[model samples]
Target: MKTLSKKDIKQLNERIGREVFSKKDLLQEECGRYYRNKELVFFTLPQGRLAPSLKFLLKDLYLPKVTVDMGAVKFVVGGADIMRPGVTACDEGVMQGDLVVVVDETHGKPLAVGEALMGSEELLAATSGKVVKNLHYVGDDLWNA
Candidate 1:
């Protein structure tokens, strides 16, 4: 892994819509071309956007959230897209195409990070069909890396 330069870090911050990395040791890993600090990893999605790793989600969960029922926890952790039926709650202000965290209702622990397929109102109103596209989850390759 190589340390990121200030220019690279600035671009990354813009892509992820956050300015969390300033002086932290930012290392670029080859396993997934993920950017990492001492405690968190950030990965690039298929669309070329940066996303938070599950570990990062746990540490700084400022993203909008969607709570899933216990029955959905297994699928979520396995990287299944969050379905409408399984969602028990959705934070207001969630918009379509926004990054969101999927958490289990029992303990409210993040199970996966996903992209919202619909807005908060649409997610809460829908009865069936996928609502959030799972991006990263526990036991995924990125997680293992």
Candidate 2:
């Protein structure tokens, strides 16, 4: 397992407003993805510790490097929500129906894995489409959840 930095962990704790021991310690898995019971889990996963006004968790795993400035944690560990305004960056190679990794710009981490409603650039530049609504946790199969 990739060990997270203590400094980064501290920031995450501050942003989340909760004490964090480790990244793995904060998650629970179901099928193949991991998830947190709380919303905006990214708040507790950033190096800034400051709560991100906007963010997203898109992907099968977390980046633990990508951080954002403002935005809500759109996607959680499990398939949850993915608002348009919260989207920061997307895989340019993704398609409207392809599975893609959504990320929280604030902390630069994958928030959730979901079907793409729009492509990467479109998701970033355009102002329409689902852009990624169907989200599933890295391990929790929302299909079953």
Candidate 3:
């Protein structure tokens, strides 16, 4: 693991729209690092995108989220793309091409991170077919890495 320089941390904070790491936190930090903060949260992505690890979702950070019914939990955590039927709710203002966090309705815990295939309005109006392309999920290589 490579430690992040001050500039990197600053950029990351900007991308995530909040202060993620304090100077103290940065002392032990590194780029492309994933750690368990209750679950697993990636400190950084290869492209420098900051995303909440599924475990981190439990804290309810203010990222765009799509909630799926209990019936979809197994498939979502297993890395299946989010289909329209499974979605129970969508955070308002989600747009196509945006990154979204996928969660289970029962616990509101994240199961995966995905790219929206449709806007929130469109997703809510549809009854079938894919809505979000799953990018990272529990038990995927990134999760294990």
Candidate 4:
């Protein structure tokens, strides 16, 4: 478990809008007293946190090592309009602007990586609009990274 330094605690107080917890309080709040030596900590995004919140959690919260992968999900891919057709299926519980691993329809492998343009349910329901907003090239996507 990585303990916060004095500077880190001060910054957390400024960002979280509360006094930073002492080491013992942080141990309770962050680890529930289950201390481990692992450096890579896995955390679920807090409920109702949109893109801005994620950005803050990463940039300000010292979550330097994180896997933003949304795992498997369903959403429309490659369409002129986002709110219309082409949505074969999507995974579950994804939100807009989330970093996701877009899979290929044929082989079920990663086709590309990008931020979601709409919620999973919204993408499934709508027939047209931008769906998965492309971010980087993968498996020979036409766009440049």
RMSD of each: 1.8, 12.3, 2.9, 11.9
* TM-score of every candidate relative to the true structure: 0.90, 0.42, 0.80, 0.39
Clashes of each: 0, 33, 0, 15
Q: CA shift at 10, candidate 2, in angstroms?
A: 41
Rank by TM-score (best first): 1, 3, 2, 4
State the displacement of the C-alpha of residue 129, model 2, in Å, after optimal TM-score superposition: 5.2
Off by over 4 Å in 1: 29-32, 37-40
Evaluate model 3: give its lDDT.
0.77
Worst 10 residues of 3 by lDDT: 22-31
Question: Model 3 over residues 1-145: C-alpha lDDT tens digits?
Answer: 5455677666656777887655444333445554433234554655666666655665655669999999998999888999999999999999998889998898777789888999999999998999999888888876765
Off by over 4 Å in 2: 1-70, 74-79, 138-145
- lDDT (Cα, tens digit) per residue for candidate 4, span 44-67: 233422121222233234211111
**Which candidate ranks first by lDDT, i.e. highest?**
1
Give the range of the ten consecutive residues with the poorest summed lDDT in model 1: 31-40
Model 1: per-residue Cα lDDT over 1-145, one tens digit each: 7667888778777877888677565667553465664544788788877788888778888789899999999999987999999999999999999999999998989899999999999999999999999988988887876
How accurate locally, in lDDT, is each candidate?
0.85, 0.46, 0.77, 0.40
Please provide, for model 2 over 1-145, each residue's C-alpha lDDT reduced to its tens digit, 9 standing for 90 to 100.
Answer: 2233556566555644556446455443222223354323332222322222123333224322221124545345435556666565565466665545555665555555555676665767766435565344444523233
How many residue-pair clashes does candidate 4 contain? 15
